[model samples]
Target chain A: MAVRAVVRRSFYQDSMVLMSVAARLRGQPGVREAAALMGTPANHALLAAAGLASPEVKGAAPGDLVLVVDAESEAAAAAALEAAGAMLEERSRASGVLRRPRTLEAALAARPDANLAVISVPGAYAALEARTALRGGLHVFLFSDNVSLADEVELKRLAAARGLLCMGPDCGTAYLGGIGLGFANVVPRGRIGCVAASGTGLQAVVSQLAALGEGISHGIGVGGRDLSAEVGGTMTTLALAALARDPRTEAIVVISKPPSAAALPALESAIRATGKPVVVCCLGAASSGAPGTWVSTLDDAADAAAALLRGVSWSPRAFSDPDSVRARLAALGPARGTIRGLYTGGTLAHEARLLLEPLLGATGHRILDLGADEFTVGRPHPMLDPDARAAQVREAARDRDVGVVLLDVVLGRGTHPNPAGVVARAVRDARETAARAGRGLLAVASVVGTDADPQGRRHQVEELRAAGVEVLPSNAQAARFVALALRPELALALLGPR
Target chain B: MTLDAGLDQPLRVVNVGLELFAEQIEAQGAAVDRVDWRPPAGGPDIASLLARLED
Candidate 1:
């Protein structure tokens, strides 16, 4: 009687016996448990026939256990099994011919002219992929976010060494060599080049420039957190130097939402040394005695950049006259109480404080950075996170020291779906709480984005205004108005030209 | 039955098991040959042999 023999081998030891038979027996259907133990040719031939084993599997010896399985039949089952194994091997080899190649080797073989690799992998895997692409001698357009600062620095260093471009780890937007990569605005190519810290702000400036028939040589987005206290403005410095050197860029625009004082001096020095005409728009604040050009609002920044590109010097203009706001506040009534500013953007809150501190004598009013933990408690990006605003409205409304409450609502894609609802609810709650406390609440608010419906952000602005919150067009203007309400004296200071 | 015919030309054994068997045969200085076997092509009975191998 014919009998079936089944063999099993573990990878721990007896490695040699497994090699010979592994290839042939690996994918064959007839083979059950095939392993080599000690030195045995029994499984080696089986593996070789199945093509399951690697080239290294051929040298397996006896006294090492290799596994093999054979189905017994009245006829020669081994030959039939071997034929089946060969057919399977033929199919596998043919399958490769039938399928399109997806490996790097295949891509290079197909398109030898492909010089750039645009990577949009997950953040954690970005560095690895970037390193691989660099090793492969391809320019990288990295579009991943949440990459650590150290990784970015190291990657930038590697890219510089390789003489290749490393766009971003969290770089949401960029226009590279006239190609729009990632989430970039379609702006014409012109003599002006821009490097912005904020993504949406960059979009706004680029769109506005395009509208004015001005173009950009390049608009590099140095991830939002680059200019913050922690990162120390590393990418900004690099971008400034690059834009400065580019011959196509007759004028350069460096935009950020204000950097820490320590970061400013270094950046200022770099800009002054660039010798190229520079328009610096630190969104919510004026440059602190820096010599380069300055603009306060995003719209004005775009205007300045367009004018500079067209060989014209555009002076900074106020979005809304601070005096008008002060006059309006005075007309409302006599000095009521302390002013309160609850702002989404940290830079906006800082700007409001700068405007109010001198006028309110620093102690008369409060400026809260809703994005700050001390104010919002465990909330991130205050405009997107509703819980923070919910708590803030109640606190501001209940405080007897607070009479005027100023809010800055930032609206954009990747933000809350209904920012209007958020603002409306917060306003209603605060108003009710203040009314119950028998205090009059003067609520002034501002919308950050445009009417282009950037994720229906315009609706939020309309809702806030409809709900009786005095809405301004820009954060800078809103913060200025908030400051004037806090201190009538600062209004006069702003009215005087510097 | 001609059982002994072509038996001396080195038995062409195929180990269609898992990675362990592949590793073992690879170490023995013999090349492994792998083939893809599916149901529609009518291959040998693997489950019964596997059960026997376990036993």
Candidate 2:
């Protein structure tokens, strides 16, 4: 194979944009591999490890953008690099002639009254930017990931010392004063507020709230590590206190993947101190919830929050229409192989694993988080590029032991405009591929969205249904439906006449 | 810090890095200004930025 590398000095782009561009280059004809990353030590090390480090890379300054391509021929490699260059040029052209401030200080000078700084730089510099913002008397919404635990702790402490909030180093969802950030849904303003450690977890609950005719006051994301032992629930506690003090937030909801042993007590204490009715969804964990109601699923969290706001009692339901679900599964006949779950949302995938393990055990069920680093290291998030999950669906179809395929389609701003429509094509292709081998594939999915979402919930759901997928109302229900489809007799016995 | 009592002052946002976040805010009918931010070295050099910050 031939390898080519080019370094463009002082050329800057956000990490996500470079990652997506590199992924696109890899898909070109005759390309073996492609990478577009900043010339940081870590990224340079990555290039060396990939065996594509050339003399150009060695000579590159730390501030340069290194583009490398490994292809079957020298001509192919050069052509792909040119194509990548064209893509970057096109982006520059599309941005128009408006000048943008290069430094935070300059930006602040331009907008001195700005209250929050949304930081999405690379993980290495994320904490530095966050620290600058906090010191400048601005709350920070950090959207970068891969930051060190020590930096996260220090940043949160600094924010707390200044009586400000440090939302995340990997946060992807939040809403403040009717403004949505990261991957968020458009919902009406209401009395219920949320503080979550999960991005899609926050989106799922808020979408459910909007569906139930309740809305959100503010949805704060404290990043995934906020509840970890190292971070000690620093931001979670702070966010809870902030929400509790907000006069418009009549009720508060907190979501996470169950806090660490050391952090749980403090979180529970913070909840009790709030003096507001709190609903907590710790994903799959079984906790006493102490001062607040502990729900099992993201959907349940929203239900509880809505009920609290409306001053009504609410309970979790297995499925919206059990009879219909059972009838549909009963017709699908006996499933012969294992259930394979392809998910775009990491938390949703974890929730599926939690729900499926007791019934199918560790060996019988397999769930893949398509959004994980392993799957998205040099590619766009699965929510933006469906190619990764689509490829996985085809792989599952070829596996004779795979009987049921489950998926989660998350919709909102900053996500694919036609997620359901895109996944529908994959579902159709996979089923057709499986049928050609005389094997049956039962596809199940849950679309996390609302009617108010730009993707149009009804339209997305109808698209999935039309593609032969059994569309459930929520991720948990979709998991349950998959369980019933794969082992109808056992699942029915467990439910006991439903 | 005291939480704002309600939806205060039409929600002016300062997006430090990602334009997408600001776009989402704008789509929600809020005022948003993105910083088109770069690293400390005015490039993709996180290593240099981190080294300087450590100083």
Candidate 3:
């Protein structure tokens, strides 16, 4: 086998495009491993970790484009490299057919009255583009991650000062006027609005609300760190104010990874100032001493918000069908062991961890957000493609200590069309793997989407259930089910708060 | 309407990166302008420097 590296000076393609090129080459005959990347230090390290970095590759500059190919023969490596060059050229030609604007400025100039700019550039350039959009008086939905906290604070403050919304530096989901944006679910338009610091958290809430015969006014994501002490809930507060003014919005839901104690008062103040009933679903947030109706699970967030809209008293919900879920787990007859959670949404993973750890203790469970940076260094997020999570499912099943595997299949635009299928096959493989080892594995999961979603919610659930996976009604229910299964003595008490 | 575009006015989107996202927006029947984003020829380090200058 031969491993070779080639560098092209001053050639930069979109990182997503390069990653796709890498993925395509990996599928080619005789190719064992490949990566197409700009020679950033991080990329260099990633390539090196993959054993694709030759000594010549070690000296590459950030300005250079690098392709490292590992193949069955020297000739194969050269051929693959040539193929990579050809693909780039073809993509470049296809890009010209549209004659798209090369800069945000150029696009905005053409649509001077454009109100929103969805900035999804690489993190290094995202802030600059976002700044330009905000300066041009557009509400910014910034999708790029790795933006510094200082930049986030500045941009959000600037947006707030101008009476505009700056959604995220790492925000992945939002909906405006029934229009889904950046990994959003297609839910109907209604009076419930959302301000979330977690992407799947918002999806779970809105989709649940939709399923409950409620719809959304808007769902805004304020990046993950907005509620950190440093950023101090800048965009969260602004989004609340906007929702408050929004005529269609009767209530709001605020979701986040529990805000820092230092940031809570600011968040609470914003919730109060809205002067509207709000569903406060800060997953894993400490005891509710704040204003507005607070709920623990994303499921209850929807139930409470819809109830508020209906003029009915809101109550916390346990599981949709506790008896059936319990029976399913009992039938699995697994040993009481640790939980292994493989998740696509960071928020959903955080929710699952919080729900289980308090009872089971944190040490017994291993929860992972597959879309997290560690899993996506040189690959697509599991949301865009399900292979990473699928591979992890098989690996996690091999552990005798893992009793329950918690999974979430979040369906939306721009995500894999058949995430549920990939997960089903993975779970089936996991079950077979565990059975061969004379161990048992129980997989519990939830679908976070409405029936209108392209990958229909019911269809996804049926797929998992067909594979012997007990798919629950909501994320919180799935997490709680695992807890109940592990500690059957806890019983219905596990269904409710301890 | 001026402060919150989605309140009544149609959402006018300028998708600034990732061509696929633009296509999805368009597929949803929303009016969107695609920004064919390319990094600075010098790559991310140069992009960072350019960002600082833009700031």
In Å, residue A489's CA in model 1 sits off its true spot by 3.7
Better of 1 and 2 by DockQ: 2
**Which of the two, 1 or 2, has more lDDT?**
2
DockQ of 3: 0.59
Looking at candidate 3, what is the lDDT of residue A183? 87
Query: Highest lDDT among the candidates is held by which one?
Result: 3
Worst 10 residues of 3 chain B by lDDT: B1-10
Report how closely model 1 matches the true complex, as a DockQ value. Answer: 0.01
- Model with the higher lDDT, candidate 2 or 3: 3
Worst 10 residues of 2 chain A by lDDT: A489-498
Score each candidate by Cα lDDT. Answer: 0.57, 0.82, 0.83
Model 1: per-residue Cα lDDT over A1-498, one tens digit each: 222332222221212122334445545554444433332344466566675355445554432233334444424435534544454447446645234333333454554444445554334445655665556565555655546777676666666566555656655456544544444444577877888775556666666676577777877766666666666666677677777777777888887877787678778877887788888888666676896788876767878877766777677654446556656667765446887777666556665666555556776677776655344221134444555676777688888888888876655433455766777787788888888888778888766544443444457767887776877666556656666665556645655542
Q: List the residue pairs that clash in candidate 2.
A: none
Write down the TM-score of model 3's second chain. 0.61
The alpha-carbon deviation from the true structure for residue A295 of candidate 3, after best TM-score superposition, in angstroms, is 1.0
Q: Looking at model 2, give its docking quality level.
A: acceptable
User: Which candidate has the top score in TM-score?
Assistant: 3
Local error of candidate 3 at residue A246 (angstroms): 0.8
